[model samples]
Target: MTTTTPDMAPVRLYGAEHAADPERSYELLRAQGPVALAEAAPGFVVHLVTDYRAALDLLHDTETWSKDTRPWQSRVPESSSISQPTQWRPNVIFADGENHAHLRRVITDCFGLLDPHEVRTLTFRHADTLLSAFADAGTVDLVAQYATQLPLMVFNSLFGMPDEYGPRLVEMLAAMVGSDPARAGEGAQAFGAYLAGLYETKAAQRGDDLTSWFIDHPNGLDREEATQQILLTLGAGNEPTANLIANTCVRMLSDDRYFGTLTTGSLPVQHAIDDALWNDSPVANYSFHTARRDVTFHGTRIPAGAPVMISYAAANTCPHQGVPADGFRSGNKAHLAFAAGPHACPARDLALLIATAAIERLATYLPDITLAVPVEELTYKEGTIHRTLTALPARFTPLAPDADGATPWSRSSADRGSAGSPRTAPQTGAMASAP
Candidate 1:
């Protein structure tokens, strides 16, 4: 089953069915050619590059392929969802050349200031706080109760946002990514206004947060640029992390290969994360590159100003890719989940840290966790770029929150393991076990 626009060519990825099982669609697209053209939306045809080597070449050929969408302004309708203006933003994601480097350096440096140990600590704390809300309920939607809220809480702390503003910001972000296209612009506007307020507040009184750091950075970003950078971080950071956590949990609960070893205290949490990255990356497809001029590569001609989107999902899973031959092997971080080239994700390390901590803590606290519904019933949110689960309903033995706001089987407890008991060396696994 495939969907097509008025032109009768298959609409590459804009329906519920495709979202549910995008890999199958990717297979079909790959069958056509390495570079298949399809309409992402009505009258908005895009080149979906699926071949691994081809994608890398395009990504690295920054001179021929640009990130700027200004050339597309005249080609697409102003109101079209795929129009350049609709997605235009002056952030690292859309910038090229020196502009891209300048914006990205500040973000990279800001993330570098975060201590990995501290990030893990904060992640565990936020995970515990969110889990406490649903730990008493034997059955709960993990996506809503834990996965979705954990990153937002952690980001709120990182940005030093006021407690009152966190929930509202999360709500606006959710609405922006939600099913309703009508609300996206409104959400973007609200998000900008809220960040502008944060910028003003941080300007007047600095805090030990990324926002403050950006404001005071030697790069000298003004309030508007600072706000856009904050928006970029939040927009790129939150949903992908949420999806990673949820996706990892789903694997832990459903896959006997991992579940059996995890229960037996053999499988490392990082292995599950790496596996998810290879097989089911949260942000399935991204890195929209536009042709700087008329170019023909691999026998396909991409006209000047044509929009090209790389299929990270398809590239990672392509059988001919040859990197992960055995599937989800630990220490194999070659997957393009973080993308490649100059515009790859800057905060990938932080993302991995938070995801590992969240998953490890969740597994430790709820060792008996299982799916509330059949695996077949799990559905994905519909979209071209993201592979987000609609919800993750899970069942686990109810755990009581400790008086000190810690789980009985928290990391410390796992480390100390009952004061007088002889400490056995922790079991070695495919990946380094979480500390």
Candidate 2:
């Protein structure tokens, strides 16, 4: 049992204070030692692992830690924000041992079948479509306009949906995870129906997409199993990838190493992405594990069934890791941005491809783009798991459509509103943890 004094009370991980400066929260956690208690929701306190070695050991020790959240879920309110991520599902994320391996193989194998070149080409196409919507405008919010939509559009195509359904899918997902409970419930239902219809279509006639591959795979998953797998992949990949893009872009634009010379710089986009992974990871805290029995983790005695989460942001910056004086983390990939162990991210390569291509494509079109406001003025969203910016306002010289009229955005301004605008409105509250 844990007792708290006035100075040792659990630190709240959500709201404006944590959003503005999550590092301060980490500082508080560190003072309590490697494993400390933090309030994930209003009243849900969980043990947070803030040290690198402890996080790694805990992640790899499956015998002591279980991914299953049923024990923890029974304690939290159905309406609590933590319920969404902690909710049990029939996917690899919540499975253990053999079940985890069985489900994960389906995802890894399907992802492996994707040709790197095709994935890059697909990413570039969507990036162009999104950029075209705002190329003529002198100012745009990269978070809303480009980063958030690109991954959703690409994943929709990969999952065998027609291009026309991309916008609606994005809208449904945003609402499903948005702050408003009523809208969130409605969005969840709509997204579920959408997934069912997608599986149905794929079942009737297979296409060369992930959905078709998932259905036709030798694993022979039933409709419900296949649907849950697809849902897991989509929900896991979307927001983290979006935030990776936005965070990398913001870092490059703000740092002198690449700000003015984004196109030609010693620090490339990959470096910025890695820096964000180390210092400001998109998935701040996740990999929820419950102690199988009484265990002393880093001198802290966590009782059986206690919820423990890994703080990727804190562990990556652990002073023991010794960040270089210059603050560059590109060549080094040891960071926990993707977590570790068997449950580590399976689609990291695809995410890297999409994020790199999105940033490179933006630079090709808007070489002179600059931030509309000071970097410090940018606001972050309030959440327990993700480090996301509310908006990324930027300015650039307007580029009109070419003389031959092949580019139609210049011809009609009204289309810009539909095309360039955010595919889904910004939502707050619980977000699905990326695997």
Candidate 3:
């Protein structure tokens, strides 16, 4: 097995090279062993688990691991971009044992209250509004205009906020997840303030939305508890879901097999989505855990409270796995894109619903859309936690509002105009590079 000396410099995980071709980076890390070292920031060497079996073992063996990051944070600089996501919060992601279960139940129950049909309808509605802005433009950046903003708008409607709140929320979340230290700091602060205002509004007047339900749940979470849960849901839901939509679109359009299947209606859209999850998991490497005590994992010795991260991308594409005879991964949900075990993403179903709806809606309107740049030229944004495209330039036939105004895009524009607040097209290139 590959090993490292104390003087060995850890592999850098944040840069254009790593983001552009993470599979190569994973291969380098795997040469060091299933559990190898990588530099997450300038000086922080985090243990990254690359083997599929090893990752599953860690995800499933929670008793030996703790979700809390308090001990590990002491070693990381407070100003580092890597610190923002891993910083201790009392939410489900950081809590352990009964507290985790308690918070998780509240979130699950709240989500359970959501109607899947309504969620799809909300997704379709937002997709139309976003598309209406650029549906007539022959060339559009799907990443900047459509995929990035649709989820936040759907989330805003679900959380009992006016549609106007979507743009600023997008900015705040993008900055928080980006690699820039200063922007991440400011994003975190803005996000907290935004949530605080949301809670204040819901407390005064309850609405039929997730925020209101969270505030009034039987679990009886205080303002901070409820707000933290919302933060986790939106922050976790938006960027990854956006990436999934864009990634799936790219996959379906670029690959001839998927193109033929989609055009002939022989394969369902979910097939392409699952393939993307297995191959290009939106959340590349995350699910940080600290050792509960000194432990030896997968033949490697890890000290007490040392930080270990699971590479979902590396594990999903693990070279040892058996491939289907047909060379397709459709209908396989075994990948750890949403992670696994007790801490698996609770919003898995909702995220899938939103992503599927967004893709379907776009496909219906722009059936001939193709990548503006060759697929090989696409670049991902630099960040350790997510695999985000810097831009997805696409060209499609210009779709104009029907003369009778029967199309969804036309109807949506008409409704907005009647509301005395027409939705303007978001500025091209205004979208933040990473979220």
Candidate 4:
């Protein structure tokens, strides 16, 4: 008798001595080979697809790796406290086959119609107003003042609401999902309740904003369903976007050459985004998935019904086969901060545009703007799913104009925000000891 079994061993992402760094964790997986078996639970298992090529193989292979995990009631309960089997709201990303495709199409039509040129224009106008507020101020917290506030303001129009709600929503969602799962679930529930109220209000009017189409869809969406979709969208859409802008600024500020390239017009808005997407991806993880059937990667066998954590962050940096063919330069690419395959982010187009608009506006207008503190002072937010900044202290002095008599404020620079104590970074030695 000849018998052969795939290699299945214990490989821990987090060693007892050190927390798992995404980059380091991935390299370990790569060294072990493309795919490895992980014990997701005692006596239960899932495949861990760690390498870029193998991940893409599994992600796009819907037949072998299905997203349709029906009969999930006993599996993914709403909350540990709740006796209820499951919440009825599942985003399109969680669905598989035609159902997923259909939902994505409807949502895209509802909110994806913005003209890029107009977005860019709006970004410039908003930047002008925001920059003007802080031009005189020598320093400010970039995250609290600008990064967190901007996308909420920009995306608010899509829903046709007052920018006033953006701050509240941002706060609630921040608590709900960024890193802390338990706290985030609490926040998610609260936000869900608020969304239910808001959707009911919008349904009555059936206005032209996102609510109208979503609420009374000919296809069908009741108050509960509509609320769930909206809640999911808001959570999924905003933070990554805000983080994207914040990340871009952080990366550029780290190196004068990167900033100079943008300010000098060597890089357009889109190019800057591409550079950042590769260098400083914002949302660095996607939800875990399960393999529906037996599959193999690099000769590693994955039995049916196993959970898999696809490393989008790892896949993005693959030297040979990362990103789509068209986007990769030298086939070297950025982090898969967004995942690939079936659950690839649906709002990618909008996120990229919004980010580019922010960058272009800043680069074109505030060429001389510089961070008040050195980039080393920054604390980069990193975790299983999100990457953002706690703060980026910055100061800007607009350039004096030529003989043309053009007011420097009009052509040169614009908005500033949040009159907090100017958040200058402490000196290295001082920062090391304080707090």
What are the per-residue Cα lDDT tens digits for candidate 1 across 29-69?
Answer: 77657787665655667788887888888888899998977
Candidate 3 C-alpha lDDT tens digits along 100-126 = 999999999999999999999999888
lDDT of 2 by residue, 1-435 (tens): 333233568998988899998989998888888888898888888999999998999989999999999888887666665677778899999999998998899999999999888888888788878887888888999998999989999999899898888888888988987879899889999998899899999899999999998888898888888999999888889999999999988876777656654323336777777888888898999999989999888878888998888999999987864667766666789899999999999989999989988887776556667789999999999888888899999987676664344433333353233443322211221111111
Ranking by TM-score: 2, 3, 1, 4
Give me the runs in candidate 1 sitting further than 4 Å from their true place. Answer: 1-8, 73-86, 179-190, 261-265, 321-326, 404-435
Estimated TM-score per prediction? 0.88, 0.90, 0.90, 0.74
TM-score leader: 2
* lDDT agreement of model 4 with the native: 0.57
Better of 1 and 2 by lDDT: 2
Note the Cα lDDT for every prediction shown: 0.75, 0.82, 0.82, 0.57
Q: 1 or 2, which is superior by TM-score?
A: 2
lDDT value, candidate 1, whole model: 0.75
Model 3 residue 22 CA deviation in Å: 1.1
Model 3, backbone clash pairs (residues 3+ apart or across chains), number: 0
State the RMSD for candidate 4: 8.1
Q: How many Å off is the CA of 17 in candidate 2?
A: 0.8
Best-to-worst order by lDDT is 3, 2, 1, 4
lDDT score of residue 435 within candidate 2 = 12
Candidate 3 residues lying further than 4 Å off, grouped into runs, are 1-9, 175-190, 260-263, 325-327, 409-435
